[model samples]
Target: MAQADVEVVEDMNVEGGPEAGEAVQVLRRVFGYEAFRGSQQEIIEHVIGGGDAVVLMPTGGGKSLCYQIPALVRGGVGVVVSPLIALMQDQVDALRALGVRAGFLNSTQDIEERRLVEAEFLAGELDLLYLAPERLRVEQTLSLLDRGKISLFAIDEAHCVAQWGHDFRPDYLALSMLHERWPEVPRIALTATATEATHTEITTRLRMAEARHFVASFDRPNIQYRIAAKNEPKRQLLELLREEHAGDAGIIYCLSRASVEKTAQFLVENGIAAVPYHAGLDPRTRAEHQARFLREDGLVVVATIAFGMGIDKPDVRFVAHLDLPKSVEGYYQETGRAGRDGQPSTAWLAYGLQDVVQQRKLIDGSEGDDAHRRRLSAHLDAMLALCETVECRRVRLLAYFGQESGACGNCDTCLAPPQTWDATVPAQKLLSTVVRLQRERGQKFGAGQIIDILLGKKTAKVIQFDHDALSVFGIGADLREAEWRGVVRQLLAQGLLAVEGDYGTLVLTEASGGVLRGDRQVPMRREPEKAARAARAKAKRAPVDLPEEALPVFEALRDWRGRTAKEQGVPAYVIFHDATLREIAVLRPASLDGLGGINGVGENKLAKYGQPILEVLAGRGTTDGGDAAGAGSGSDHAPPEPPDDIEEPPDDIDW
Candidate 1:
């Protein structure tokens, strides 16, 4: 893609930039926020005072402002090292819309574009300059940076520096050079998701061990966490979109390219606008699909893990996982892509027995030494624990990041608590069957055969092996096959059972001896069938809390935004977020000053789009696009109360 055209506001780029004490002034005038949120002010002031820092904030926690405001106050271009080459344009677009003179140098830019950006940087005409980490490897790029007046180095998505992180990038290992080369320049490394281990790894690898670390709470209470047993996942996903999130933008993640294609096709066949994205698609095709998903409304992108790394779109309503994620970090990062507007959204997953079996088989057959396999296994174990936990999902998730949080009353477990049963006898029976088959018959088999023998199915293979005559045979007949599968899955999750070989044969782990010897009791969660029913009964779509009269104004403003975004060739949120529009509708601002007082209406935006927004508010430029409110305002039922534990930001804060 060519560079996006941005009309730089010359007045904001004056020499001797705003003083450090003017941080709040810059925040209000440039970004249009009245106050700092959480630790944003602390982080911004620290950076502006020439102190290195590390920030671990949630997705919608306003991480950008931590560096953007500091860069604006500290003067000179803030050199940002980002891994998102595809998203740099959108980031710069958003900043330029705020009247911040931002530019980027990446592979997507032609030589002319790169030269122009480099010229702007050398002349001190840009406020922020974004570069992919890999670009710094080039001597010319380093020389270019050395020649420019530097402000600070901002590393976005710094978790990629962790060697064991889910989204590790080798290019990030070279980022430590920023510290060595520019010792006087302040630097800030930021990520939305990281464990204590990953955090330490980032600090160590990025040479920021002494930097003041700001670890915000990992909780995103606006997202309703739900995991259901997989039964016709495609159909379940279809029902979720149609019944709850119809006409809303979402992302559906699958485990394989073929699954991505199939799921996208399924949704499109069912009359939902959807597209497929995976590594298998051609680069241009992937780019087109991503652009459509970003620029258009209510478009679903079915992808593997290859997508959604630095996506800045703020209105994604749901993120559904058809297959299991390998780790809580991966799950958290993917799910964080939803509810970024601080609106009610969903992080839904469809997990089942096959998911467990498949993951184990992949690990066993993976090309790694024992230590690597062990690491992968540990990550999977944590994820499985989260999926199978009877406690609150959010609590378990936050616990993984070394944070403590109470049971969020919105997750699946809190809403409809699953029952736990003592499955010691059933576990013993299953392990005994595996033992008998291994010691007596000198044979091993997959779960299907093992389950058949346990239930005494007397299938042809069972009879051929004379398994029906075994002492353990028919011992588990009291439980149905589905229930037995659940037992095996739970056992695997609990590490009492292990899967081996290409066919996923059941085996005993070191911990299984205690269960087999009656030294330990196995407890398992009963599937939350009632929870599923209740969730289905209640509409999963988020409700708009605006007064009935304000709904139309909100829709009209959205219509105007969509058109303006199309004209500017940028994502709609680059113009203004839904949260900003909702407040505008509620307040019904009547003039430029009134509209300018709203959050997200920065000085540049106030001058550029203020009149148009006021026109829409006054019913002059209103269009017939009430579909904008369909996702959140269709239901007649009152909107659900916001969770008590979540801290609400001020009405004037930009999401």
Candidate 2:
């Protein structure tokens, strides 16, 4: 045979699979994408050619396509190991909608359901099969895999293999057996959030050290970063909701279950459709609320960290942290859930001195080795630095993930820059107050108490302790109360002050001596003026500039989408994302071909909902979608007691 014919024969005979270029064909035909993004094509080819790989892409960066496409081109079933059981069905359902034979087996399945899937697996009928890591430990599961061709292994959320990861799963440690048992099979591990340390841990633990690593940029520029000094957090959050994100879907993350309930109740009372999610709720309640949040539009979920791991909703307009996230990676992953469709979103946080104290105390009281405590402390320090940063927030955030970028003008600092002051003198006074209260008066106090003494406020505690007699008392009267609080917080962040005992009493650290002697200088960011903040909020809340005629069309399309999703028992975004709806509304696509041309309106979706959507746009359809639009809230308020695992400290101390 000629050289070309020989090559074709080799391609056709290789495991009786599609040709080498079949991966791209699968991408366009099955997934409905025109092309590969970033290193997707390269990753797919490497895995299909039977090479080990590791991928670290940001959330919403198309990580799934890396492995999903390879599964289609290669022979046999592609086994995906996922950590979240709640997310497995959604993943499988989405794949099925794309015309791929996909299935999942977990505790949620009945014995008959599992037996059917097992039979299919043995018959070589599945293109993609998702399994929770714990399933791999079953002898039947291992035996079933042994009976098949076993194309390749895809480990989703591979960062869980790292013990220090935000969502670590012990069962993920068992996944190393994939490499050990199926030595010749190609393996691909992927995560949306991983630091350099976590990256190393994933490789080491998964035994994929030799895998080719594909790292993508961690920056999500469409999501604006904003952090404010929490003052009356509930009211401030209400103001944020009213002024900026009115009638939008979003999430408010609290630190504890009680806080979740209270915040949810507060929002409901204020006329917002809100619900709470945490481990404390009954499992059925959590599942029901999750279903509602996913299937409905304009819903706000006030929840703890338990709420967002496998959330695939793309229209979350904002993620507000009422409590500082435990680590920068956790914050990145949580905020990444917003604007998954690349629309403008916000990552808003309300941070205060009490957050620092509470987080520190949690770390201190945690049951761990010294090394573990130090690691936790290091993570907290990074989180605090991100909040205290005066420069671009994106710059600091991306740098933590080993990528460098210029100032992103979308962040709060870049937009409404704060004034920095030479706070050396103020730092000295704050440190001196801590030292005097400790050494001279033998009275330890928190930031609030220390600030009262500094500003010459003779509260009952100061009068009782005779703190009014101290030399440092009233010396800080020149600065306002908020400024003094800022100094104390900066001092704590700088390691010049430490909280000791259960009361979170402030005590001077060894570093405090340098500042007291004028040998150290502290630069503090002055809080943005109230008027400047109001201006920025107003600017952000400016009405969308859609064409006059498009407004009604957009609303009608949303209504249609909502109804269709409710009837189908799926999320509205599953039918068509808000961005896709907006495109259709603006373009006013008149035919199936026109609708198919719009992004996110794939072949399958167009074939299914095309006519109804057209009718809705044409204003002849009396059919209903669901109510697809709603409003926002913010703040870092105190939550109820956290479950034992969440590490909330006692609230008796006056932080």
lDDT of each: 0.80, 0.75
Clashes per model (N, Cα, C within 3 A): 0, 10
Please give the RMSD of candidate 2 to the true structure: 8.9
* Native-to-model Cα distance after best TM-score fit, residue 478 in candidate 2, in Å: 1.3
The per-prediction CA RMSD against the true structure, in angstroms, equals: 6.5, 8.9
State, as a TM-score between 0 and 1, how close model 2 is to the true structure. 0.89
Looking at model 1, residue 285 earns an lDDT score of 80
Those runs of model 2 whose alpha carbons end farther than 4 Å from true positions after fitting are 1-20, 530-548, 586-597, 614-655
- At residue 185, candidate 2 shows an lDDT of 87
lDDT of 2 by residue, 142-243 (tens): 988999877889998898898987888888999999988889889999888999999999999998889999998998878888898988887777777776
